[model samples]
Target: MKAAGFGYHRPETMAELLTLLADLPDARIIAGGQSLMPMMNFRVAMPQHLVDIEKIDGLDSINLRDGTLQIGAMVRQADALASPVIKKNCPVLADAIAYIGHQQTRNRGTVGGSLCHLDPASEIPLVCALLDAQLYIASRRGTRMMNFRDFADAPLTTSLAEDEILTRIDLPICDPDTRHGFGEYARRSGDFAVVAVATHLRFAGETITEARMAFAGLGAIQARADRLEMFATSQKLSPALIDKLAQEAAQMPAESDLHHDADYKRHLAACLLREVLERILRHG
Candidate 1:
């Protein structure tokens, strides 16, 4: 199938982009086109106007400022994977990005695109959920910041208004002593995850001071293991605790898809989470 004919507008500045967006209510913003183009080609998406924001400046940087990792919305996946700042400040994110599509896709895939696409199995949104990311949104009226949990509305949907652009992603940097781990299972390399788990632990000597656990591919959006995360705090890492957490993860609600059943997805989630948690303990 071919995409329906549409108007194309490439804005050189954010001001111009905002104006175009405000004027075209039915317009869709195109960044990397990794997701939108496919949908357009399939006729799954038929926007009357396509606004391209690639020419806009200051939307492709990766910086660490005021203890926050600020990644511009246009930062490409491959660039982010190779970024020293990402690797140093958020290693789990770097690890997860390696599992996104293949080299060719990652080469053009943008961070903001993935977040907006909000695939159930997308690694970027999963990491953002685990890290409690902040999203900066802008429009002609004003700008606002949203929590990742609130920004994500439903599958393939976000809370972004028609005229708002996601400007950047803000991730609070974890403590240097925080240990992080990520693991995922896919039928093949570069495929979307069947089940993926990410976690970070800030330890005071032997006891956990803080723990964040999040999983993807089990629901409409990535879910944080709140109960398990709460249980992990002030607890010592041990085989028993790991086993218990894995069991709890296996009981989390899962949705069946064409490729896998709910039970199988739960099983995979448990196994992946256990592996990630155990790896963190081993390396810590």
Candidate 2:
């Protein structure tokens, strides 16, 4: 299907962009258009006005300040993946982005676009959730900062109002002591995962001090393995404990889908989590 006819406006400045959004109530912000374009092509999105922000300057830089990694709204996934700063500060993010899509898609996909799209199976939102990132939003009313968790509402849905524009994403610097791992059960190299696991383990001597786990492709929103994290924290990993964790993960509930049954996804989640946990523990 072809996209419905729409009016396009490319603003050269943030001030002009804000004025457009204020005037056009049904306007949609277009950055990389990797996600939105598809929706429009399928006729799922029929916005009458597209306010493109690509011509606007100052929304494409990466910076580090006060122990946080601040990425602009227009930063491409490919550019972010190759950034030395991202690699050094948050290897887990780089690791996850490698699984996103093909190189071409990454080259055109923007960080703000990915987060706003909020696909439950996407790697970007999973990383943002695990790292506790903040999203900076702007509107004619004013600017406000929101936590990523608060920004995500449901599958393919977010809390961003139609008139609000995502301006920046701020991710906390990964602690040097934090050992990270990411694993997913994808049918192919570039496909979305059937089950995804992301973890951060901090060790104090031989004991596990902090264990944070985030999972995707199991629900409407990326979920945290609260049961698993709570059980693993402050607990030394043993053969028996590992076995128990795997069993528990396999039994965790997930919604049934048309292709895979709930039980099958749960099983994959168990396998992926155990594999990543073991890998991170062995290496770190």
**Candidate No. with top TM-score:** 1
Query: For candidate 2, what is the lDDT?
Result: 0.87
lDDT of 2 by residue, 1-284 (tens): 68899999999988889889989968888888988998999989999999889899989899999999999989999999999998888888889989988899999998889898889899989988887789999999999999988999999888988778999999988887788889988889989888898888788876779878888888888867789888889987665666777898898879877788889999998898889878866776
- Clashing residue pairs, candidate 1? none
lDDT of 1 by residue, 1-284 (tens): 78999999999999999999999869999999999999999999999999999999999999999999999999999999999999989888999999999999999999999999999899999999999999999999999999999999998999999999999999977776699999999999998898899998998998889999999999999979898998899999888889999999889899999989999999998899889888888877
TM-score each candidate. 0.98, 0.96
Alpha-carbon RMSD to native, per candidate: 0.9, 1.3
lDDT of each: 0.93, 0.87
Q: Which residues of candidate 2, in runs, are more than 4 Å off?
A: none
Point to the candidate with the largest lDDT.
Answer: 1
Off by over 4 Å in 1: none
| C-alpha positional error of residue 229 in candidate 2 after TM-score superposition, expressed in Å | 1.1
Error of 1 at 254 (Å): 1.2
